[model samples]
Target chain A: MLNIKNLHVKLEDEDKQILKGVDLTVPAGEVHAIMGPNGSGKSTLSYVLSGRDGYEVTEGEASLYDHDLLDMEPEERAAAGLFLAFQYPVEIPGVGNLTFLRTAVNAQRKARGEDELSSGEFLKVVREKAKTLQIDADMLKRPVNVGFSGGEKKRNEILQMAMLEPKMCILDETDSGLDVDAMRLVAEGVNALRSPERSFLVITHYQRLLDHIKPDVVHIMSNGRIIKTGGPELALEVEKNGYGDLLAEVG
Target chain B: MADTAVLASKAPVAEKPRSVLDARLEALDLPRGGFTAAARADAADRLNAMGLPGKRDEYWRYTDPAAFNAPTAEPLAFTSRASTLFDEIEQLKLVFVDGRFDADASDALDGEGLEISTLAAADAAGDHWAADLYGKLETAGQNPVKRPFAVLNTLAATDGVLIRVTGKVSRPVHILYRREAQDADVTIHHVIRLEEGSELTLLETGGIAARSNVAIEVEVNKEARFHHIASKRADDAKVGIGHVFARVGEGALFKSFTLSVNGSMMRNEGVIEIVGDDAVAHIAAAVLGDGTEGRFHHDDTVFITHAAERCESRQVFKKVLKNGADGIFQGKILVKPGAQKTDGYQISQGLLLDEGSQFLAKPELEIYADDVKCSHGSTTGALDETAMFYLRSRGVPKEQAVVLLVLSFLADALEEIEDDRLRDDILTRLDEWLTSRASA
Candidate 1:
């Protein structure tokens, strides 16, 4: 459902390339895990796919279900069923989480020419979803990510992805700051949202998160390029042997 | 009719008080002969001795009172009939033009547990409360910088709406102060009193014409609750100045919201004092100014926990400046000694949409007690670029994105208003003002 062909990107001011000819593809009904070391362009891939500014796409194309995702704005991409669970979500003060969520949902619905949800119906759905995610109603009433704990903010981002229910989900370092319990809860939430027509790309540096959400494919990335691909067993092998041996082999 | 004509024809008598000090005392038509006359004369002499505040005054530094020369509008004639701005409000309306009350257009409340009459009529009925509380909250000696308008309002204001709610009243009170023309100076003093356990919602809106030098005073007793929402939508040719003084008693709750849309030069000075323990006061304001010469200034001061413990106070202000207009917001929260456990918060934020637009926000907190939680924050900047880009990338136009961000910036202040109707009305007015200003 998601495809990236020889994607190359660079900083706008400097000609220094960040994503050098990276290629990836994830079909429906499967989760693909991209494990990389620090500064391997995993987060940069997420930002480019999510249409964040300050990065120029120098080469290749990214498409979501036959649509040109690279040309769409961040919000348009969101409406087009592309969701990116950011490593660091923006904190919007004075804007309540519930209000922000509703606005985003309604905006997407309006783009799709669907009827808008009433306040009562929206509140009911949000309450149920929040309960399922173990998020308090008071948290939903507060300013978005303002004064929220690290785990709480990550969970809030996951909650948004669930609400948006995108066709392609990109989890960039979703397990960075989460504890064992929080990681388990987050994995469970992601697992529950999996479907035959939906796909996910879980990008992380550690293999601990891979134990909860089993991936069908594992890819190793270094120096802004994907160097190797293997089955789920490859994740276990890397966990035991580490990336140092693999870096020498790639060289 | 004869009274109004006589006052209108006596223009030379009004023009004699040119200086700020003389202008204030002469604005009020004090009694010619009586004990009250001598007392008013003494008060006027005291006001004259104080003189107009200069730039050296700390509080008046940002706003120079010397620049605003005293207005010289002829006193309104005695007309029992006058028009109103909004007809949907059914309550009795008191009309004051150039600081003179129109007895014909006003109504008196004479029912049980309720007293609604003119200040002149109430004083004639030997109501000592009227005289004692008239200028008590706005003592010239105490607040020397911003009391010139208050002093003028006290001494010159002939007739005003006197509302005394003894018991719980269900209906809302609407006081409409309509400025007829911008030819001369005018000052109005409106006093409201709510007895113990009384509840009221007062709506005050300025008229279409420009009004110079207007002041209103409100006092709430113990256990009383009041919600005052004042809106100003004046024309560009008019210059307006207003001051609101509120003294909240013990256990009483008072909330004041002021919204200003368009004016040539406008200033609103707000002072809310919490005297009784456990009293609460919430002051919120939104001011919008545009055009080359349009300027708006707001000075809000709130004193909580004066003698009462555990008092709570909040003040929030938002301003939008465009074109060459200027907006100023100065808010201070004071927690007096012995006022323990006081909770106070003050925030002032402004959005400057153009290069020539200017905003000055000063938020301060003075606490004498160590066991209190008081904080003040001020921010003045353009719209958030990331939020704007995010919205624009979603197919939203740039203009629409700006409108959304501006509205979001003002949402916090607007949410403090409890009445939905008033809130919606003010939002609509703001939207219109923004659109027109942008187009211009």
Candidate 2:
């Protein structure tokens, strides 16, 4: 569902290279996990894929199916069935949560040339989805992410992911601020969306989150490139021995 | 009526060269044979005392008063854009073209608990109830800050409407000002008096003229309520100055909101005095300025005083500027001695769409009461980048995302409008302006 070949990225404002000739790919309906040390360019890959500003791609290409992902705008990337669950969800005041979701949903639908959902239809679908995520009416009525707890923000992000039904999903440290129960809840929400046509690239720093949403393949990233790829047991090995032995073995 | 020379002799020494003020005054003639004759003469004396505002003047520092100081308005092409803001609401309509009341186009000035008359007709009657209120509130509002243009408006105003409400008015009084003259230099003064236990809503829309000075004096008695909503949408080359002076009595409510769009130079000043206990006053404005519309510069200046115990006052102003447009806000809230438990709040914010645009704000709070709650805040910023990316990543187009963020930035000022329908109407128009600009 997603492919990257020798991607290189650097900061736009500074002379700092974030991602150096990294290469990885995730097939359809598969879950792949990439674990790395801090400042190892895990988050940079997600940002560059989502078409955020202040990032310059110096080399390589990435694509979803036949479409060149780097050439599309963020909204176009989204309309092409790509979703990124942010690590720190932005708090936008004065914009109602329901209004934002409705706008986003209709926007993508319009971009894809699909019939827009009516208000009543949208309410019904959102009500059903929010119930599973344990988001109440107040959460939907308030301003987007403003005053929400960390767990609530993560759940809101996953709820958005569920509503969009993207073909390729990237979770960038979604487990960073969540507690045990919140993590379980978020993992269950993500797991519920796993289908034969959907794929996930889960980026986490711990095996604890992987325990909830098991990955088919685990990759160890050091510096800017992935150095090792193995089964789920690799996550346990990293949890026990840490990246010290893995980085030394690669070196 | 007093002659210009006699009034000038009684005036204070001109702060600047007297040539400018003298030439401006020499070009205008005060209305004769009116009940407002004595009041107009007093105002003329006051105007001569203050003279025309200079750039160095304290209140005029942010906004240049050169346009108002000119002897005649620079000729402008009349715009044909008509406002359909309050057409859906049932109301009494009054139409004025080039500052002259149109008797044929206006509805009959007859309504239950309402007495409305043109200033010219009322002045011809020799005497009226508004005689006591004529220019009284404007004179009271001159303290702490001298508004020479408002004084001049009261002195040389050629026509306006006089309204007095004795009981609860069932419908709003809608005043529509239309411009048909290119070189129309217009002055209008309105007097409104609401008796005890009465309520009224006044709606004003459209542009007055190429250059206009408009003032409204409101006297709300005990337990009365007054709501004023005005929208100014003039051509890009227009220059206008508007002032509202209100005195709210015990247990009364006074609220005023304005929406201004697409003006070259516009200044709006509001002075509200709450003299009775438990009175409430609110003044708010939303400005949409685009410098592409000919050197856009808009200013909002508000001063509210709490003189009685437990009085409340609020000031909310928001501006959205783009393409080098300039927006200025100067607001002050003062709580007098013995006005215990007074609650005053003021917030002014500006959103600059580009780096070239600028927002200047001055928020002040003066409190003499020991037990009072007062807060003031002012902010100038661009749209939030993180929020923008979040919306765009969620699939909203860039232009649509900008409109959403701009509307969200203005929601606070729009909330000050109590009527849901009126607020919705203003929101609709604002959205249209933003959408059209985005497409362009």
Candidate 3:
């Protein structure tokens, strides 16, 4: 459901090229894991797709379900069914978590020409969804991500994903700061949302997260381009041998 | 009034350079008759000594006193607000039209554990309890710093209310001001006393007139409680200056909060003295100024003194400005020699929505006691970019995101309101203003 071809991007304020002619695609109902070392542009790909600022796409194109993703604003992209789970969730001091969730949900609904949920209906659905993610009433009442533990923030992100129900989900290092149990909970949340009409693109540096989510395909990226593509077992190979051997083999 | 102004200008005092103070007093009309005649005369003498505030004055450095010192208020097109604060709550309502008490619109001045009288009526009587307290606290407040406008208000205020509380008042007293004349200039003074072991809440709202000067002198006696909530309504061309001078006795509690929306110029000053041990006092304000609608300038100045041991005082002020709006804050906390264990906190913050807007703040603390804990902080900044991106990424529109951030910035000042319903009402108004302007 997501496609990218020759995506070349660079820092908008400086003369450094980040992503050099990267190309990849993930089809519907499948989870793809992108494994890469530092400065490989794994995170930059997600940011470019999500329409973040401070990055200029000099060449190439990215699309979601035939819709031009880079042509829309951040909020417009979300209404078009693209979600990015951030590695670090922001702490908004006075905006209550539940209030934020409701606003986001209603805003998207309005943009899509759908009837917005009333407060009562929203509370019921949110409570049910939050129960699965183990987010308590207090967390919902508190300000967004303020004073939240590391695991709680990750789970909160997953909760937002469930609520939004995007067509394409991109997890940018969701497992970076999570413990073993927290990682399992997050993976379970992701696995539950898997459907034939939905797709997943997971960018991570470790196979620990792949152990629970079980990706359908694995891609080894180095120097801003995907160099190797294979089955899920490819992740295990990289885990055992490391990227040093893969770069040498490619050379 | 013009004739009166002319007559006052030709007074016996020597004419020296026709200074701003002299020119201002020349244009002002002093009250001719009142039960406060003696107090008015005394205040007039003091006012002449101090003179009208000049831009050169230390306290007036950040804000110009030219508008306030002008004799005639500039005319404005009056537009009634859609709703009034405290509309849902049942209470005693006192209405004033351009500074004159509307007896027909006001409720009967009789209630449980309370005594209320109009200053005009009290002036006709020979003796009254208010005569003893009227302008007393204000006279005491004019020390270490000069507040010539408040002194001028005492001598010029023609009508107001005098309230006395002997026990817990069942319902709050609501004072609602309304303006009809476009160029109305009004001066109003109120004196309130809470006797020992008594409690009372006072609510005020509306922009009294095109130009207004108001003063409320409050005395919270031993073991008493006094709560006040007021608002300066959005009037694009309104200029208002208000003051509250209060004295807290042993174990008493005093709290005051104000919400100010768009105005041409507004200056609210508070002078509080905690006299008895263990008393508590708090003063806070949340201001929203948007110069795109009109010329917006707001200033909040406060001075609090701790004279007794173990007393606590707090000053919190927050402002949000955009489109070239200007905001100023000057606050100070002073602890006396024997006032050990005094706890005082002060914070003033401004969130400027655009580069054109500006905020100026001065926070000071002086402690004669070695064992006091007094801290003050001031900051001015724009909205957090990372936080803005976070909100926008979640499908919240840019305008809605801005409204959320502005409200968040003002939450600290709103938290000072003790009543949930009142606080919520103020929050609703703030939200409505931000949403409408953001979309505009």
Query: Candidate 3 residues B227-299, lDDT tens each?
Result: 9999887654799899999999999999999988888888999999999999999999999888886889999
Q: Which numbered prediction scores highest in lDDT against the true structure?
A: 2
Q: TM-score, each model?
A: 0.78, 0.93, 0.94
The DockQ-derived docking category for candidate 2 is medium
Candidate 2 on A84-182: residue-level lDDT in tens?
999999987767899889999999999999999999999999999999999999999988899999999999999999888899999999999999999
**Per-residue accuracy of model 1 over A158-212 as CA lDDT, tens digit each:** 8887877788888989998899999999898899899998899999988999999
Candidate 3 deviant stretches above 4 angstroms: B1-19
TM-score preference between candidates 1 and 2, better one: 2
Q: How is the predicted docking of candidate 3 categorized under the CAPRI scheme?
A: medium
The pairs that clash in candidate 2 are none
> B188-278 in candidate 1: lDDT tens per residue?
5566788888887877765523446666677889999998877764444455567778888999989988877656566677788788889
Give the Cα error of residue B163 in candidate 1, in Å: 1.8
lDDT of 2 by residue, B1-440 (tens): 34346436745545363568888888987687378999888987777666777787778899988888889999878667776888898899999999999999889998999999999889888889999998899988988788888888888888899999999996899999888888999999999999999999999999889999999999999999999999887344799999999999999999999988878899999999999999999999888888986889999999998999998899999999998999999999988899999999999999999998999999988989899999999899988888888898889889989988988888878888888888888888888778777854
TM-score for candidate 3: 0.94
Task: Fill in the DockQ of model 1.
Answer: 0.21
Query: What DockQ does each listed candidate score?
Result: 0.21, 0.72, 0.70
Q: Pick the candidate with the highest DockQ.
A: 2
**Per-candidate total of colliding backbone pairs:** 12, 0, 0
Sort candidate 1 into its docking category: incorrect
